[model samples]
Each structure stands twice: as structure tokens, then as C-alpha cells.
Target: MINSSAFQGKKAAYFTLGCKLNFSETSTIGRLLGEMGVVTAAKGEPADICIINTCSVTDMADHKCRQAIHRMVRENKGAFVVVTGCYAQLEPETISRMEGVDLVLGANEKARLIQYLSEAWTDKTDEENGLHRHFSVATKDIKDFAPSCSRGNRTRYFLKVQDGCNYFCTYCTIPYARGFSRNPTIDSLVRQAEQAVAEGGKEIVLTGVNIGDFGVSTGETFVELVKELDKVGGVKRYRISSIEPNLLTDELIDYCASSRAFMPHFHIPLQSGSDAVLKLMHRRYDTALFAHKIRLIKEKMPDAFIGVDVMVGTRGELPEYFEETYRFLESLDVAHLHVFPYSERPGTAALKIPYIVSDREKKLRSKRLLSLSEEKTEAFYARHIGTTAEVLLEKAARGKAMHGFTRNYIRVELPSSQADEALDNQIVTVRLGDFNSDRSALKITL
Candidate 1:
């Protein structure tokens, strides 16, 4: 209901944090505003409106969101500022009171932000509703799927095929913030991907909070979705963002190995290798099942890249438990680890659990896991040296070189002189050479 004239000559800038899902949603919002006649604020330029999409995965994410909001207000004086996404959904009142924040929308209300901007924005007064506005429909009301895709990048697009999570893990607030798991029909998603390819996207990453649990409402499966997506004509590649260990079936792994466009890369969350910690965290799978999943992927696609999400210093994770996780990871063939140190959230089940991990211990464990990740990544890269792989080169130039990722997800960087503008967004077979120490990017020979 916003007057179209209001956005006719205005510019808006967006800042996204957290997952690819957030990026996709932000892009969708930008596209919607563009249709309403608002242009994007160019890089390093100020805009009349600034939208900040936030994440609240941890306490640190909340701190970062506050810092970003404050910085945006200071830099873009008098601009109408909007904050939305997970953090806003969890703490809408707090975000609303922040100086210069014009609107605070939650997960359910965010998609309808344009309408609110039209109706509530101009009517609000300092005496009536204080400085900022807030709206958060209950999480239960956020049932419908909001399809979003990132199209700004020509080489790759992150298509949000699914949203929300049903699994209420002990230490996680994603389920509370995002609501239950849901996704669109396969026909709808296929059409979305086709449109993305028609717009010049070469690859799409299927993203969600819990994609492996796809199709609770539609009676479809993640495997079935991928099979249909594989038949899509224009797109050359698709990558599964991440899947739960218990849900990553052997059938899916086998299919990816022989599929036409699916990449041989898997990011499975194995929050802890210790059985005790896994139980305490309410994870669906144990270390045995996780290891079996890894074995299957490696057996089918030996050169496949596997990433692990591991958390350190969760409640009840004693010294013995920490050692167990570290040793198990060391024994596995995981390419890298996304190591997170646990931080207690207010309403999570972890709050009820005894044996809180000291901050000092958490930092030490996080550091140890990160160091282990470096070793695993280096070894994974070393194993692929002297092999040839198909790489989808990205558009951006980092320093004097351009970077790309192989089908197995090994990052490769080539000199800009060697990679012409025509090479951008094109798939090229390149010989993987030695790892470059200076750049930390794998060298590729044309």
C-alpha cells in the first residue's frame, strides 16, 4: 500500500549476514523494491534506506548485529533503517528501541515488509509509538514457503528450496526463530531454477535450515527433488548446501556420484563425535551413522569433498568428551570443519542441563578444532594435486587473480592475465597444481 511515488527516485542498500538463505531472501527483497522503482545503492555509496538482514545463531551474532545497526545509523544519517531476519524475530522489541531503527520485522512479517512500509511508516509518531516500529507474527503463522534466490552473482545462485527447522536441538534457537520445516512443490522449484538459468546463472546451491527433512507436507523427498532438478536443461551444476547426518541416505550419495549435474560435495553436520554429547544435544544420529555416511560418499566418489560442522564445549562436554570428538575427527576423511564454540541461549534445553563449560575451556577447544580443520583441508587439497577437474570460474577478481571451485569443491585461483573476461562464468577443465602458500588458494594451470 506504499505510494509508488515514495520509491520512484529513491535508492536502497542491503546488508546480509549469516547463511545463504539470508542472502537469497535479501536479494528477493531488493528485487521487489526495484520493481517498485527503487534502485540499489552502489557500493560505498549512501542510500536513503538501508535494510539489515540479521542472524542470531549465537550470542556473537547478536553482538555483531547490534554493531552493524549502530554503524549503519551513524553512516547513513536520517535514512529509514529496517532490521529483519532471525535476530529481529527473536528480539524484536530490543531491536525496535535501537536509535534510528525505523522498522523491525520478524520472520513472518518480513516478507510483507513493503505493505507495512506503506501503511504503518508514515502514520507513526514519536509520541504514539516511540522511535521505531515492530511487528512479529507468531512463528506458527509463518507456515507458507517463501521462495528466494540470489541472482546478483552470475556464476552461482543460492536457491532457498526449503526453510525453517523442526528438530529442536538442545542448544539451537533456529527452530524457534524460523518455525517448522516447509518447502514448495517440486514443479514450482524447477520453474524457479529454470528462470535462474534463463537469467544467466551457471550453478545453483540448494539451501535450507534442514533440507534433508524436506517434503513433510508435500509427500516428496529431497532425493526426488534432486532427481527432478537434474533433468532441468539450462543449469550446469547444483550443490546440496548441507544435510543432517541421519538424513543423508546412501541412495542420495550414490545418485550424486553418477548424476549429470550434482556435485560430489557433501556438508554434513556432525556436531560432536562423542556419543554422550550427541545424546545431550538431541542429535538424531550417532558417530557410527555419521562415519558410515562418509564412507559411502568416499566409496562412490573418492575425490568428493566432505565438510563437517562441529561444535566445541557444549553443556556436559567434559575433557574426555572433547578428546573423543577431536580423535574421531582426526580419524575421519573430512575435508574441513566449521568449528563453533557453544554459547548458551536463554530458552534452549541446554540451559536446564548441568555442567556448564567455562569460557576459557570453550576458547581452547575452538582453537584446537580450527587448527585441526587447517590440517584436514591442506591434506584434502594435497590429495587432489596433479588431477584435472572441471571448475566454474567466478566473476569477481580477487587481487591479481580470479578464483573458482572444482566439481569436488577444491578452490583454485588463476592469474587474471591468464583468465580473460570471457572466461568468467564458464566451466573449464583445468589441471590442479600445487597449493599457493602466499594466496592460500590452489593454483590452476589452463
Candidate 2:
């Protein structure tokens, strides 16, 4: 088989389906193909090949995947479509059967794509014809690790130190989709982290489905990873994207409180405040534990930004239970909320359980929680008013001002500047001003 190097002038298009991790992976895929001299092209024009990095956090993801494939076929009939990632890993047969799918590489087999596709392309002329290839594992525990994706445009980078999950919660398909937990060695992780910092990233966000589970592989733990990243060069701040309250330790919290690099921000998932509902969801932690974790953070860093991940609709969660959840959150000092109206996925215990929350009810509950989030967030931000906070100025957002984040993760928009200092990871002291009408962020003055 000829190397993809033979297709020096050929084009490839990357379509990423999900979170920041997926985006990072897609960018890396493009980068590798670019190094092989196969460059990515803008959409609409027919590319010789296409890579669709898929996701399957929900059933809607499958629908979107199919929709994207159909659109690709319509746009460029002869383009080769290589499907990989979570959805591809779980339902290789389903994706393989899709029209125009030439290659289907599962989560574990994705890295083999360059080799497989290169061989296929060299021997074939019809790029749109689906290839006879599928790679999937029945048991996640024994699956191999395959890393894709790379860092991004910000002074901040997302290093996927871990992959897959061992927690087979009743409502989750992630363990089946992503396979067992596997991560890079501490030395490898530090190499990538340092590389990101060297590449001009001023901050790095530790990203994963379960970052708290990061260092269970090595003798080192997630807490130790934080300490190591603190010592790395050029990185000013480190943020955890989302962590389980149960896995979040006091030692880690204390480290963040004292560390110069770790940011004072915590995003903990609290599926339910009702013990009965929490039990049904199979979450490891209860309201008491979650609340205690929050208390610990606030006790250590009063100005910390606390974000809660709440699922509005789930089985066994009665209206009273929702009120319990709301009241529990209200009792805390959380600054924001990420509300997900529980969407049922097939093959999950939650789907079979009776009395699922109606879409309307889910919407209502989501709205109610969001309102509380507004009040809590505004109150938290209001506490910092009339004082100056050190902010990392990001590239401008919208029209008029430069945008960045405060130490506590409060996004602030400052008056735009071309002093060359306000670009990228420039740290500047900005005075707090009035709230932006959006209520999503703050407008500040430099």
C-alpha cells in the first residue's frame, strides 16, 4: 500500500461531534494528515477524503451522525468518509452500514485510520464506496488505548490525560462506549503539558469524562498530577473541566487553595439531591457528600467559582425530589449551573425505569434551576464588585472589547486594546464594571 504521502495534493475534511476533548482530537487528526502533506480543506468543495470524529453521549448523537453523513454525501458524492470515536466504537455495524462510510474505526482502533485509509485509497479509485472494515470490542476492560486529538488555539490547552471509564453506573453507556480507564504515564502527560505550555498556552485545563480518575493507573494519583502541572513552565493557570464530587479530595482542594497555578474553580456533577433519586441514578456520592465538598472549597477559597452539573429529568425523581435538588443547590455558594434535561439513551436502565420526567416538565425544571443559577451567579459576581481582579485577557469576543477570565473563572469582557499586550494570555488588572445584558458574562474596564 502506498503511503498517504502519495496524495500530497489531496484534501481531507474533519467534522468533530462533541466536547472540547473531541475538538482537540479532531484538530490533531488534521494536523497529522497535514504533516503527511494531505491538507484539510474548507467545506462545500469536494475533498478526496473526510474524517468524522463522532460522539455518542446521547441517542441524538447518532441521529446527528447520520445527518452529517447524508450531508457529506450530498455535498461531495465521491469523498471517502472515515468514521471513528465513541459512536463508532459502540455501533460500528450501524455506522458501517451508513451510506458513503468507507471506514469505521472504533475508539480503540481509531489511530490505525491513517494506515488503513492510506492502503485503501492507494488501491481504489471510487472513494465514496463504503469499505468493508469495522473495529469494535465487546468488553471494554480489555480494550487498548488509542490517543487522538491535540491542544487548541488558546493560551490554555486541554490534555486528555485519561480515556474511558470503569464506573458502570446504571444510567451510563460511557463505560461501554469508551472502554476501561487508560491514561498516559505521568512522564508522557508532563511532556504533553509542557509542550502545550511551550507552544504559547498560558493555561491548561485538565479535561476528561472523569479527570478525578486520572492517576489511578500510576502509583501517582490525580492530586499528584496537579502538583506536577504546577511546576511545569509557562502555564499560569490549571483548571479541571468536570470532576465527581466523590473523587474530588480535600487534599486536592487544599493544593488548589495554596498553589500559584491551580485556579479556584470547581465543576461538580450533582445528578440529584434526593437520596432515593441519587441511588436510582447510581451516582457514587449523595447530597451530603457533595455539599461537604462544596463547603470545603468555599472554606478554602471564598471567592472560588463553583459550577454544578444538574440533570433536570431522570427516572425516580419526583417533583418533590426536584424541589429537594433545587433547595440543596440553593443552600450552597455555587456560582453557576449546567443544566441537562435528561435525554434517554437506549440500552440504559433509566430508559426502562418507569415515570420518566415529561419533556415539558424537564424544560420547566431546567428553567427553574437556570433562574436560580442566575441569581446565585449574579450574587457571587456582585461580591467582587468595586475591587480589582487579575484577569487573563483573551482574544476579543463579539465587537467592542477584549475578553478573558478572572482567577475564579468569571469571564470578563474588557475594552479592546491593540497594545499587543491584550492579546492571547496577557494578564492585566481589570476593574469590575456593570453586568453584561446577556447575564452569561461580565463586562469589565481595563
Candidate 3:
């Protein structure tokens, strides 16, 4: 048996790379350690433990994770390093062999972090077990569902309603890394949200690998989950993270349009606009269905902000197909476009495709979509200028201007003179002004 007192006064530095889901999970881990008397290390302070959560979304993401692991190890010398997340689950052997890594936990094993840390601490000085590189990974049939609701250094909380994915898209490795689709019961999630409200959380973002497939584990539906959450008092705002186009039902969209706290912002993934490319990628929906969803959201809520995820230069994306994608995106009335240049993930069906987009062509296509995104975003923000909207102010450093987001997800910034710390986390009414000098956010007048 390990004594809990052994963890007293220890400081841990957390490094998370990848999606919001990773951040939420890391925060939960921090809280678990906090219960054992471990506190987060301050900036520029050397930590006794370093927890690194990694991502494997793309090749570039993997590279960044490696760099983060190395930097954390160097900055916090002699810290007991622990790595977990999608990358650690997929590449345990590689990460375990890293110079400073002491323990590598997989997706399922991360829950037993404190137990493993205790064992490591007891056995660190054994010369026979020199440089202990222990790894606990469960890659096949990942069935565990770890519930997480954390507000890590932010005003809005990230509530992970679901985890894992069942969809096996040709260019994706999420299903392999995160296991199958799973979620907690609606009652459990509602309780979690209520707890967040009690803790002064005004906003929450529902995050998951495949949130729309939330009913697989529990017999409940995603709409049911949303309805229950809306009934939670004191939750001023709720935003659904990226969901598949096919799984976004009309009932859900209409309900959000009239719901109490659900925001008028939707993030839908339209990987490709070309039907041929969609088939090649094994996507569930085509451009027609995607366009219909966008239209329905606008018809129900004209002021709704629709953000799309578009991937360029996937396998078999011929020149004409690329043009088709460009034209289809050009026709959409979306508020923003998240453009990504496809990276070839290993062991996927996309590798077997005959045609491949060159790096130069991929860069070109990505540039075109990004430019279109900027144009659409500018137009979306301009339409709201001179209009009145409620903004939820977030905490800012002393003497720094405060920033927040509107109901439709428009970023608004206050003047530096109004950077009062008292206004942090307060929702206030403001008039949207013209774009700031950088055009990144609109200047607001209270």
C-alpha cells in the first residue's frame, strides 16, 4: 500500500498537445494529483513531476509532441516524466525509449497514473532497474470511459461527453488510437455539468472524438443529452464541438435554435466537397447533405455562425477534384473554414490510392481555402458590427486588455484602459465595433 502523504508539496507541470479533449483529460489528471497534495508548478519553476499529453492527428502533430516532450524534460530537470494520450497509445515503444521518459501510460492506463507514479518513486534508485522505462498500453478494444469536466486555466469549461470513435475513415487513425465510441449516462453528465455550475463555470464546450455518436454505450441519444444539459441552470452558454455532418440531425439543430443556453455556433467537418474525393476518403456524407445541413442551420437561426473543417490534398484528389472542392466551398455561406493539408497516416486505406497530391499542390490548395476562410470570416464579423450582443469576458493579465466571445462566437476585445481584473469571467452587454488593427477580433464598446 502506498502512503498518500508521500505526494505532499510536490509540483507538477502539465504539457498537452492536440485537441481540447486532451486538455480536458490532462486537467482531470491534475485534479487527481491535487487530491493527493500535488500542486501545479508555477512558471519558471522546476517541477517534481512532468505530465505530457500527446497528439497523433498528423505527422506535424507528432513532430510537435516529440519537441514538447524533449523541451519539458529539459526545462524540468530530474522531473519524473509521464507521457499519455493518442500518441503514447499508438507509439508506446518509441516514447518509452526517449532519454528522460520514466513512465508511458496509454489511453486506458492513464487512469492509474498515481498508482504507477508511487511504484516509480519507490523503485527509482534501484541500480538493477536503472532508468526505469515502464509502459502500460492497451491499444486493442479500448472499452473504458473516463469522464472529465475541467476548466484548466480558462473561464469556459470543457466537458468531455464522449470518447473514442467508431468511424474508420480512410485517412484517419483516431479509431485505432482512441478505441470505439463510448460515453457516460445522461444523468451522470448532467450531474457533472451541475457541478461545473456550482464551481462558477458559466460556459462549457462539449468535446469528444465522435460526439454525435454519443448513444452507442448508453441507450440515450445526443439530442437527449443536449436537452438535459440545457435544463442546467447557471450555465450561460454551451457550444458543441466538431461533429460529423451526417450525425448532425435536423432535430438537434432546430432545438439549439430555440434552446435556453445552446449557442448559435456549429462546427461541422466537410472533409472534401468533391463527391469523388469523399468516396475515396470513405466519408459518410457527400456535398449535397453537407450543404443542406448548412442551409437548415441558417434558416432556423439566420445569425448562426457555421464553422467548417476542410482537408485538402488527400489521396486520389485529382486536379479537377481539387477545383471542385474549391468551388463547392466558395458557394457555402459559412462563417469560417478550418483548412488542413492532409498528411498520410500509416496503415490507412488512403495509402493504396494511385494518385497522390504533391506537397506543392497541397500547399497551394490549402492557401486558397485559407484565403477564402479569411474573406468569409471578415464578412461574418462585419455583419455583426454596430450590433449589440452579450459578451462573456475572460481573465486577463494585469494591465492587459480583456477579450471574450459573443453568442455567435465572435471574438471581442476591450480597450486596455478597461482591463479591470474585477470584470474577469463576467458576462456583460456590449456593442460590436469595427475590426481591430489586426482584424483578428472586433473592438467592443461597453
Best by TM-score: 3
Worst 10 residues of 3 by lDDT: 127-136
Candidate number with the higher TM-score (2 or 3): 3
Report clash pairs, candidate 1. none
Q: Evaluate model 1: give its TM-score.
A: 0.96
> What residue pairs clash in candidate 3, if any at all?
none
lDDT of 3 by residue, 1-446 (tens): 65679889999999999899999999988998899899999999999899999999899999999999899889987788899988888898889888788888777777677788887775655633225465544546577787899998999899999998878999998887888888999999999999999999999999999999999988999999999999999899999988999999999999999999999999999999999999999999999999999999999999999999999999899999989998999999899999999998998889999998999999999999999999999999999999999999999988887999999999999988987888889999999999998999999988
Which 10 consecutive positions of candidate 2 have the poorest summed lDDT?
415-424
lDDT of 2 by residue, 1-446 (tens): 54755879888877879777777777777777888888777656788888888888776777898788777766766777888878887889987887778888877677566777777775456443667467766753435655532653445577777777877776778777777777777778778777876677777777776878986667668988888878886788888888899899999999999997899998898877788888888889888899899999999998999999888788778999999998898898899988877777778878767877888998899999989988988998888777788888776454556678999988886655433443557888888877777766677776
Better candidate by lDDT, 1 or 3: 3
Error of 3 at 188 (Å): 0.6
- Model 1 C-alpha lDDT per residue in residues 1-446, reported as the tens digit of each score: 47877778788888888988898899888888888899988887788788899999999999999999998888877677899999999999999999888889898888787887766545544334234888887778878667787765446888888889989999999988898898888899999999988888889999999999889869999999999999997889999999998889888988999999999999999999999999999999899999999988998999899999999989999999999999999999889899999988879999888988899999999999999999989988988899898999877653467889998889999876786777889999999999886736689989
Best by lDDT: 3
- Model 3 segments more than 4 A misplaced: 127-138
Sorted by TM-score (best first), the order is 3, 1, 2
Query: What is the lDDT for 164 in model 2?
Result: 75
- Comparing candidate 1 with candidate 2, which one achieves the higher lDDT? 1
Q: What global local distance difference test value does model 1 have?
A: 0.88
Q: By the TM-score metric, which is better: model 1 or model 2?
A: 1
Return the lDDT, model 2, position 108. Answer: 69
